[model samples]
Target chain A: MKISIKRQYFIEQLNHCLKAISPRTTLPILNGIKIDVSDDQMILTGSDSEISIEITIPAEIDNEEILEIEEPGSVVLTGRFFVDIIKKLSGDFVDLETTENFQTKITAGKSEFNLSGNDSNQYPLLPEVNDADSLVLSSAVLKTIINQTNFAVSLSETRPVLTGVNWNFNKDNISFTATDSHRLALRRLLDKTFNTEISNAIIPGKSLSELSKILTDSDEDVEINLSQNQVLFTYGNMRFISRLLEGNYPDTSRLFPENYETKVSVNNSEFYHAIDRVSLLAREGGNNVIRMTVENNNVELTSNSPEVGTVNEAVNASAIEGEDIKISFNSKYMMEALRAIQDEEVTIEFFGTMRPFTITPSESSEVVQLILPIRTY
Target chain B: MKISIKRQYFIEQLNHCLKAISPRTTLPILNGIKIDVSDDQMILTGSDSEISIEITIPAEIDNEEILEIEEPGSVVLTGRFFVDIIKKLSGDFVDLETTENFQTKITAGKSEFNLSGNDSNQYPLLPEVNDADSLVLSSAVLKTIINQTNFAVSLSETRPVLTGVNWNFNKDNISFTATDSHRLALRRLLDKTFNTEISNAIIPGKSLSELSKILTDSDEDVEINLSQNQVLFTYGNMRFISRLLEGNYPDTSRLFPENYETKVSVNNSEFYHAIDRVSLLAREGGNNVIRMTVENNNVELTSNSPEVGTVNEAVNASAIEGEDIKISFNSKYMMEALRAIQDEEVTIEFFGTMRPFTITPSESSEVVQLILPIRTY
Candidate 1:
């Protein structure tokens, strides 16, 4: 296979594909990026066992010959070093050619790099998915969904199922939920007649994170396809396939308390900053717990470490209802929830001591964050 | 200690002094910052065993009251938590008052932090240095001297002396040299004079690195005092004291080859990038060794990794002198040395196989880098 492409364009696409490449893989060929030159375009694929990413570079772009396909063939080359060499090559265009013995030659200006390549036949083929059942969503909505709920996924390997984001979709809406038991974050988006019914699937949180990163600064619509054990996301000229986690997600609807004796509406920034300051003392405490006491029209966040002393922060807001109750919870969980809240004002609903409370923006009660309070007298 | 100070001013000063506070210090007191309040001003000091930094916030800056002192006393508070709390506090002015029992109160806006403070007597006092043996040099020159030689200092604690930068001062010039045996970097500055005879002192590389970072963005002259076992640096109401490394610095004068059989002059950026590209392949081989073959006016950098293949880069140069030669050296050392060279053109002088080579700016020989060649047939 032989091809010549514009350096900037090739590097940009290579960077996105490189994220899916594994630095270490049990199968040696899995560490390589497979390149195929066809009649009209060239495709680059990089994968680990969990996810695979592929990008296609068209043969001609804007009347310029970006990729000149001399022969129709394929080869798999080292992912990391090949990407680095291409990026550092000081030329406007780069030429890549592979010999019959799987030796790949890369040339740009006065620099030339020859890398040993594996036979393309040895590289595992990505599962083929037919375009039968697919869902389309704008990249912005998809990104927001991931960012709002991805942080709550459990990082523990002991409960592998909880390490993935669970996506549930019905005829009219899509909901994403992730929880580590300590905290649960849920986000839902409305759509016009989603083709699939109430189907639930879990995508590894790490794979979605990489996919979100590669979709940055793009406003195009993304197409998603779910299969028996694999989910495919296609956007622009890139295709991302991730293995689905095979397990049942814990039902979190019953965990969020519906009744609240006290509800406080506070400015998001003000509350976030106050908790941020109080967390300084909370961090010194053995348990990073910060207590929020709502009395009359005032809200106070306090943290105490006997050895280091204590911190008290009072923020004035519009009215507090019911009993003047106090609840202590992890400051980190609250901070993360506040940061993810996009509304100017957030409404926090408290149930009782030692129960999970809900934090949701007043504008829309659809997205909810539940934090389990710690009991302390 | 009771004082009310502008939050921004206090935070800025704390940021400087906080550089010397190491959270990993074994001594508990060393992890705290000592605050001394006087009727006229307030001083903040933080120190680990190796280095100490102190900054003074005057009562008034340009007739505007920045600090209002209610009492004159001293106390020590935990450095890490205090710095973080003050930075995140939401107020323009911060009120700090110490109770008779030594508890400290910090108030800013609606947030208040109460931290147990230690008696100032528990804090170690920095060694006093006289101004009689002091010299003044622009922060720019001092920073340049540190950057040019500090990277060569050995990071391994095995050799106590090689882990520091040796400063040699004469009546009219000062020279700084650092070496880890594998490579040596020497920088000299003229027009800087000392009242006494040549004074030699070795300051820990880590301390110099911290000092250099503080000197960044400052162009004013800094007064430096040399004592028996410590060096005092004073600038803009800030004093930095570093414990000097005690041992004889190796004599690096004879290490540089006086005359060379081969010399090559190339654009610094060109040569650096070529080596950088070749090193990508060389790094995979083992210790990142790249070979340069110089003949006449051209130089080719090549790296071969049997399993990964090879890379060849040709860099343009002005001229080459003497016998044709091929030499191999660690790419990292060459990259660091080239990065420190100030001139656009760099000249490398070589002796023969397995010998050390000197790299210097083509225009000036004051700054030199010597790298030992690696024997690879």
Candidate 2:
């Protein structure tokens, strides 16, 4: 394979391709990136079994020559070293050529690098997804959805299903939910453009997190194709494929209480900072638990460790209704929930001190976060 | 102890004090910051065995009240946690009060933190250095001298004396030298104002590095006091004390070659970037060795790995003097030396192909760096 490509463009695509390559891959071939050159464009692919990323650089972009192809062929080069070399190469254009024996020579300006390449034919084939079950959404929307809920997914592998973010599409509404038993984050969006009803897919939280980083926040549409065992995301001359987790996700809709024994509305930033400070002392006592008591228009948060001392903070609540309640919960969970609320004010609904409480943005009902209170005697 | 201080000023002083507190100290009291409240000012001190920092906040600075002292006493509080609490506290003024029993109460706005503190009497006393043997220099000059030579200090502790930078003061001239045997860096400055003839002291490179961070690059005078076992640096209401190494530092002055068979002048930045790129391939071959051959006005640098192929690049030298020669060395050392040269053009002098070579700034004689050539066939 022979091609001349702009250094900046190559570096940008290589960065995206690197996200799919894991250093701990047992298969040595998976540690390398496959390069395929055609008459008009060059495609780079990197994978580590769970996810694969393919980026295409056309011969010309926006009437400017970004890549010039001389021969059509394929080869696989070590991903980490190649990316590092490309990033540090001090030249405007890089020339890459591969011989029949898979020896690749990369040259740019006065510097040239020759690296041994593996046969591309030995690389795993990308799983195919049916186009009929595809949906298109704005990249910005997808990124927001992932960022809003992915953090709440279970970090432990004890329950495999909880390690992923469950996505359900019905009619024109798409809902994303993630939970780690202690807390849950849910985000929903309605798009009339997606006419096809697709089945629910459990995408590993880690995969969505990586995909979000590669997807720029733009108005461009990203086409997502779903199948029984695989899902594909195509956007901006790139394809990201991830394996779907095969398990039934638990129903979390009933987790939110219909009625609240007490409700308090407070400034999100003030509440977050207050909990953050109290958590410093709470963290020393183990479990990072902080207690909050609401009465009238004032809410007091306090935590103490016999060894490290205590912290007490009071934040003014806009309004409080029903019976005043005192609840003890994980400060980290509350802080994360408060940070995810984009609105200036958040309304927290509590059902006594033992049940899970729901926190929602005051301005929009599209996002909801629930935290189970820690029983502290 | 009781005082009310501006949050920003308190934070700045705490930061300097935090540097002296190491997390892995054997003595528990050393992990805390000592706070001594006087009638007119508040002094904060933190220390590990190697270094101690004391910062004083006057009752008034520039006619503005920076600290208000209601009582005079002393206490020691955990450094890391106290700093964290102060950083997150959201108030213009922080009020700290310590009882006779050493229970401290820190309050700001509506938040309050009560922390258990240790008696100041339990903290180790800082070593006192005599001002009679002191010399003063601008903070900027001291900072520059440290930065120019500290990187060459031996990182390994096998030779403890080489781990510190030797400061030699003679005839109103101060010279700092550091070497790890493989390479040496020397920075010299002539201070006519210092008339005293003081003995040389070997200051730990790590301590100097920390002191440099706390010293702002300004024209303010930093008074350095020398003692038998410790050195004190006083600048901007702060006093930093560092223990001195007892052993004699090896003499590295004679290591500089008196005459050279080959010399080359090249653009500092260009040479650095070229070596940086070539180092990528050299690194894969194990010792990160790269070779340079100069003849006439052309200089070629090349490095090869039997398994990764080879990279060769030619850089235009401004001048090449004496006999043509080939030399091989660690690319990292060469790159670091080139980076340390502040001048636009750098001149490298070689003494034979296997001996040590020197890289110096083309326009300044105050700094010199010597790198030993690697014997590669």
Assess the local accuracy of residue A237 in candidate 1 as a C-alpha lDDT between 0 and 100.
91
Once fitted onto the true fold, the runs of candidate 2 whose alpha carbons sit more than 4 angstroms away are A190-198, B190-197
The residue pairs that clash in candidate 1, if any, are: none
Residue B51 lDDT in candidate 2? 92
Q: Candidate 2 at residue B354, lDDT?
A: 89
- TM-score values for chain B across all models: 0.97, 0.97
Query: lDDT at A364 for candidate 1?
Result: 95
lDDT of each: 0.88, 0.89
Q: What total of clashing residue pairs does each candidate reach?
A: 0, 0
Off by over 4 Å in 1: none
lDDT at B299, model 1: 85
Q: For model 2, how does the per-residue alpha-carbon lDDT over B164-269 read when each residue is reduced to its tens digit?
A: 9999876767788999999999988855445555558899999999999987789999999888889999998899999999898887777888878998999999
The CAPRI category of model 1 is high
